[model samples]
Target: MITNQAIEELVAKECERYELERSGFIADRQAAIRELVAQTGILPESCSLIEFAEWKERLLNDWYTRRRFAGFFHRKSEKRCMFRMVKRLLQNAVFRLRKKQTELTLDDELKMEEGRTVAFKLSSAFFEGFYKKTCCNGTLFVSPGHLETVCIDELSLLFPLKYPLLYARLTAKDNEFWEEIWRLIRRFVRFLVVDMGGKEDTEMIQEVSMETVLSVQEQMERGKLEQITSARHLLNSLQMTGRNKFREWLRTESRKREEILLSEEDWGKVEQAKEDRREVDTCGANRRFDYLLDIDEKDEYEVCCALVDVLSYGSGKVYGELVEGREKLARAMLLLYVENKPYEEVVRILYNTSDTSKLVNLRKSVSRGKEYLKKRMADLIKLYKRKGEVPFATE
Candidate 1:
């Protein structure tokens, strides 16, 4: 459990330490930032106008980390609740910075939620380590039941590593993403040195003044962010010409006028469409399967069981039959084809293997599974067709 007294004491100790080292570190950081600005000339390009420059400076100084931290932890009691507030502080700071950087006039929550969902889903889809169910509100977690080091700045680093798919999509737009990256760096430095009192420890503070902060900043300047961005761009280009692109290209080139890349918002729509179809299928399939098998469906899992029951109805109880495997294959077929997932992604997700040979074998299995499903499910298909219905409902 956490209490207001503990929080206030923490804040007081942190603020006192910050106040002691504030002047020197602030001077060092602002000088380092200005030196970088002078050297790279990136700042003036973004803030060409005098007003833009002044506004950017005001944003830097007035964005007090102490106030933000206190505003979140002033009265929080539960440790979990206090940590959640910490996460919120990180989120809100990033959201505010993004709104300022892009000048996007949309609702903050709307923008933040979309961005978070995109990051979460892309990480889950591509990275074997990232689990969507386990992530806390799209922020990175050290492990299950622990979420200590989840700053938005860390996410800025992690997203490019794991959420490259979304990064590729965003990079295609003519937006100020690089400028946002710079702002993220600045915000991270401010949060670390001033807000969080990152150097309050015993030895490191005495040994190296602000080298930790400056090293990270220097690393960022040495093309790290650009490297990450360019790598994603190259990968996306390769994917465009690779096997993944062929099916989509064939589908779209015949009818569509432009190349279609899935953006974050686009992926959100795709997931929403899946959910909507799942609901309709749950209702219709429950009714149809009940009529066919004389059993009631209680949930979506039961609906899947009903489908698997159809697959097993004619299977022999003989040896070496692989009855359960075939039933699982049938379910995978429905999820792959009926749910409209890309074959590569479905294979990647189900098998958790990126081995090219295994993927090739899985792709072949999917084709065979589809044919088997068509043959075995002819009656159900005919029933739906006669009723003028599609498997997954449109709209």
Candidate 2:
């Protein structure tokens, strides 16, 4: 409640000489402040000059906001007008929230979980091929088992001529969105490079054909990318409107188009991709799928999986081979580093010394595989920000 002393202090401080000396000019300050205190408690903290100033500003802004809408309903009784304003406020909030949701979309785990298989053919000698591919291309595999080459920087794709899959596929009304996705992918690629050593091999290293990684990808999963294309087309066909009734109706109509867009078998193929992932996540350079992870030690993959599950609404499944391979190679490399194995010996440990025949004279698959794994390790580290991933084989 407003105290007599507080009112007297404010008026006394403001009163002019004549007003101050004037007879019995007692203000109706007690009732006025007590009502204010009843409406808004006058706590000890609120009594501070700075806090009072801030509170006054908030009160004025709120008053202005309410007044703006209050004008529209003022014809109604004050109680009725207040209720009408509340309804308007709720509607306004709903519309704004819908707009925000429209700006962002929930990515399907099926899509996020599918890693596009890529192939890189090599023609140069071991060291030379290694140098070329290593310096040129990168991938952005964001989904669980699949590494979506979100960005292929400083390098170009040859086959299907579909270098950037998203560009080749995604058709969005907002051009800025495509650019933003590209930027995020580029960031992911650069992170991978920096994570892998971000450095070119000081000397010549091994190299491989695009066929190997490509074959591994195909073996890991199946189905042509026509589905991804159709899914995009279906997505594009969607109307971008905010009317609640319209949007609900659109969802129903889209399902019919989806049946036309994809057969039951196709949906099963993509949706059932988790099985392929389970098979793929098992294998890497030397280890099997389940073998790659340090089951006893909790890891970044664990964290990544948790995040994916949350993002995908708990049904997200992460699986893949080369990623498994990369993790394995990285783990082995870390072990090797600890063992103080030299470069040449490390190479022997990686591919087994028996395959030396694919040598200096010919551009062999060995070199390409080595570089691929190196790049893969780099990619994982870049994506996850976890270090000591490429463990050298110590034992």
Candidate 3:
């Protein structure tokens, strides 16, 4: 079993290893920057802003080229060294053959030559930016404080890589521990990103340092990590809620703008409209002669089931014509209304979707079914009346 102490020790060791690697990287980067400044003969204070920008772009291009080439030789384990060596040899051979066959232009030859020497170049935009930001009066001078800032930025990128090592180590002993830790790290990173939008790497890394990891470990030991995670989720939810409320407020304002307040004459028109509706209602009341007998719920279900059976089995040409190849609709209605299944269940049984958003579509299907039944109810009543076999009790 991986105890909390064991986990903490492992984290501390990994963090120490990361710090060493980060320090070395920063030292190397600073040295490279100094070399490039000396070799290029472009003093930062002497150059115009445009020239400085172009120089930085060139440095970035060189860094990207070197990084890409180094990535080719990066191995996860020492066991793969022989394999990579063989692969590299084969690639070199293929490249030589291709070079011999093709007529290389001056540009192509220069590019190839640059590729060969890219490993020796020490131009990294990351470090260049760091140098500019941390230097005193734009001078190419390295200090411990500048190196620390750069190290923090590099650690932000390095922390994610270290988690997989923790994951692998904990898999045999305590998988849940690794998972919980991973969840906290992921949530913390997301919260940082959202809370500090478009901030520089160093600024973001200030929140994601080794101290933060140790704090998380302490929180996990005390069983408070879950509460912390829940708080973060609540914060995110509140942000979304605030945004939604703002949208709702904007919509309300828009609607208020579109609305026209009524004058006294408009009020009189509203009263006149009420009177017209009452007159229509009175006429409708007087014209209705046919009465529908009330049935209990059980009887209603039986009658509906019988009607569905008639429609489904194509009992008559009229029934078949009314159904019109809407068997799926009929089934959906039966499951949704008659069976009293929830929309999600009906969707799973019908459209195979449990997604809440898709439940609206199921509701729409049930609504269409209701409308179909209402529209065809008159036809069914007429058919039953003509045959003198109406299912319901009549007046």
Candidate 4:
């Protein structure tokens, strides 16, 4: 029987010729596949579906194959794919995750199976080379590619597929000085300040206490405008009027009352509040929020800012090296295969396979590589509890 991989490739390949010369996304996908195949070339001349499947079976054997592809459709909470939204901004957070590099395909039958698995034996030297050559102090990730015998020092860097949307909300109206962080607000505009280390300068609002933040909401609520029913009206309200001077002066006096400066623990409380305002699903508890920050906590800021920028900007000597490492990851697609011998073969030689009994060693190597990468990814995330701090932290 034809494997799912074969079916997909065949369908895409055949469909490309009939449709294409059309304009739009469908045409773009066809062109992308054609280009990839042209650049990477087709499978080995004799790599037929049955022979490949048979080779896969031998490589995994009954013991391992049963676990990896089996029960793939089980109601395992994390494994099952789900949909989430972020209103007017980008929807669907590209799930940054890691999984085993497997050649076998999964569909109806394979999804229904249960618990067949395989493992690989990786060399310690390879691990060291993988991290050192590919990363810079947990900031950058090396490019991904397999079946290459090259050292990490000889890797290429890869960038994110797209730049994440980041914007600092401008609280002050008619302010020409605060022009730098004006992002295209596809969603509702929200203004709040963050204190990674300093107070707001460009476009960022000055950090205020949690009590003041809550008090602002309460004041709006007493006026029967808790909904912030109109964006323009809220902005106008924020501007001081002649009659509003008295209340504004009162705020200034009360602000002096807060001048004692909160204790460190109390400060941590604000940090935690800021985090919660983002509505991030940390620790698995869902708390409700009705204020401006809670409703429009910018998701794009955290991941792209804290993670991607720091990795590139902070890596003194390793920046170029990380780029090379990431190039390997960009080339991977469903049907691509790397045939290479062990350490003796040159890394650039795509079709070099070691003198082995069969495909068993290749699968084992993939299994080992998957586990090693997954563990390292987890370790790197501990440095930053927030997803915005690191690009691949979500993985």
Candidate 5:
């Protein structure tokens, strides 16, 4: 019953509306990106072309990853690039309105009970409100029970959970800044709790919370160093290259771990270890699997950075060996796998050869790469098991 003219008109109208909506989203995203760049000091514009491209990839991956958990209600608004940003703005407005009406009132008298331990109930909604009101633009992944005790140690874990992408972006010197952010959040929480009750009543709770954050940050840093050390030991064991190489690697890595303190020079060795891990799968199954598994754990932002590192640094390494001097192999991998670009477009960009011959070869390489990655992961899992390291298990 629909005429061709009517369909064309409808399509035109839809296109016009989409363009208007997209314009608004672009403006908001630019503003947010500006703030993020300033805060993190990772200026893509100031960086070299290669660094800028990697930064762009990281942002694109982050945006894609956040979309997964953003639910329909958040995505319905075509006026923002990030659903989390929209949600934060909405929460901020609502909280401001509520603040004007009254102070933070408790749901029950039990919350006001004068016991030595203050019984504070942490809710997801309240956490969102707090984060929004404080203007902490970083995305969070905390359950309602995450702040059950508000212990400083427990609160420090929030930094890692709240900003996994940011955590991955940090260098050694930048890592210390987490303590400052942690302190800010802790103070914000204390202000809210104290506002709800008398300062005298909340003083002890605030002190305890501060202590918790400090202790937790220390523990987290220590654990990170241990993990890096364990990875190095495993890589050394792999160098044996024989029947019992895997077993020997595990034993040696654990035994020498405490003795081997990493100096600045040793960091390069660690990066080489990661490259070896990537190289384990010759045809390439394990690399893809490793990436997929990490994406699930870290969301897209961290995964994108990981991809950039591999592509940028893996030259003359395992990935280079497989591609056999195909200069565009890394770009091809990013376009095909990370960006999920179409075959025709990828070929055009990668080789300017959109023929079936190249397409077939690219497809085969991907398939073989995945197989190789899986074999590598299997070995990785075994090594983790031996060292009591939590392996990135395949789904």
Candidate 6:
């Protein structure tokens, strides 16, 4: 229903709008770049837009590489304090060496004033080529969507900076500069398609509605739209019930997936996999305790059997002695060790408090409880070994 004539008219209107605001947009971007350069001191002040853009790309790339390396090293050396200290010292040394090398290279390059003039000429030529590629005869293409895509892509290439500008020391304002340009282009396209009142717009809306209905029907058949009884119901519910209600329904349904009916053999395989995982976890836990206790390799099986029985008896006595009127410590130990809950979870469950002081007290109590239990267990094991029996007395 949309003709080339209508498309051309929309494009022409958009082009006229862009031309009117082009100078202001360019000036704003130039000012922002100058401010960012001043703040970061990453680029020379005399550098033109083209030089600055290139330098920014290189700096961001270097920053990303450094961040990735730092993350990897941190994770690998998490438990090694000495290794981490050594790494920090080495990194500082390398940074100083690189800084010196950069200074030497800058001294050898041409003077700043001459460089600025040449950069300005190069930037002008670059913009000329950029305009030719993005426009046909200095006018936007007839297809609004295509023109929008082309403009956005060209703008992104010109300014490759994105969010999380940590390395460049740039602020959100730098990102907003490019975003504003994209918004202007998108606003023009949206105005033509959505706000413009004409036969073409009406036809376009109807076509889109039909496509939406078909898409909903397909999703329903695939069991993805579980809450909606039908496509019409979905449309009505979304429109009438409002976005909040629709969002709640989506949130609930997103946690569930379409049920996949499997054969008996497949079910059997899944069960077997779960059982194997449990066995592996049990063996791993046992091995961890054995290593912690430093059990002799030759007598591991015999010592493990005796230690299990000793632990069963000793744990009860230790718990009773520690919890004799201290209900908070008892509950904390139960939630921390018995339930295997995290410190925050245990604090919440016991005191129902997120206060920092409560968390600190809970941690201290848990640490003392752990030491008492370890001492009791060790004494019980030594007694059992000495006399072949553990006495019921606390000592």
Ten residues in a row with the worst lDDT in model 4? Answer: 82-91
* TM-score of every candidate relative to the true structure: 0.23, 0.15, 0.26, 0.18, 0.18, 0.20
* Candidate 3 per-residue C-alpha lDDT over 1-395 given as tens digits, one digit per residue, 9 for 90 to 100: 22344334433442343232233322343344444444343345667779865765464345434434223223221223323333333334334443443444322321322333211111232223323343322332132223234435543343222223332333323434333333444445545555645654543332233234444444446655344233334334334433443344345446534532233454455445334433323334421112212222234333443344334333344445556667677677666544557666887988676764355445545555655664564556556556655332111
Clashes of each: 0, 34, 0, 33, 19, 0
Clashing pairs in 1: none
Off by over 4 Å in 1: 1-78, 102-364, 369-395
Each model's lDDT comes to: 0.38, 0.32, 0.40, 0.29, 0.39, 0.38
On residues 9-78, what C-alpha lDDT tens digit does candidate 5 reach at each position? 4334422433323433233433444433433324534567798656544543354245332232233323
3 or 6, greater by lDDT: 3
lDDT of 4 at 45: 52
Which candidate leads the pack in TM-score?
Answer: 3
Tens-place lDDT per residue, model 4, 320-361, is: 233335333212210122221332232223335543212223
Off by over 4 Å in 5: 1-331, 384-395
Q: Rank the candidates by lDDT, best first.
A: 3, 5, 6, 1, 2, 4
Superior by TM-score: candidate 2 or candidate 5: 5
| CA RMSD per model (angstroms) | 24.4, 29.1, 25.1, 32.4, 28.8, 27.9
Tens-place lDDT digits, model 1, residues 127-243: 212222223334433211123233444544543223344444344431343333323333333433343354544222211222222333344456444554443343333322232
Q: Is candidate 2 or candidate 5 better by lDDT?
A: 5
Please give the lDDT score at residue 388 for candidate 5.
51
Query: Per-residue lDDT of 310-374 in model 6, one digit per residue for the tens?
Result: 33333444335434565566566556434457777887888788764466456556556644544
Ranking by TM-score: 3, 1, 6, 5, 4, 2
Candidate 3: global Cα-lDDT?
0.40
TM-score, candidate 5, is 0.18
Model 2: per-residue lDDT, tens digit, 25-47?
A: 22454543443334443546547
Worst 10-residue lDDT window for candidate 2 reads: 142-151
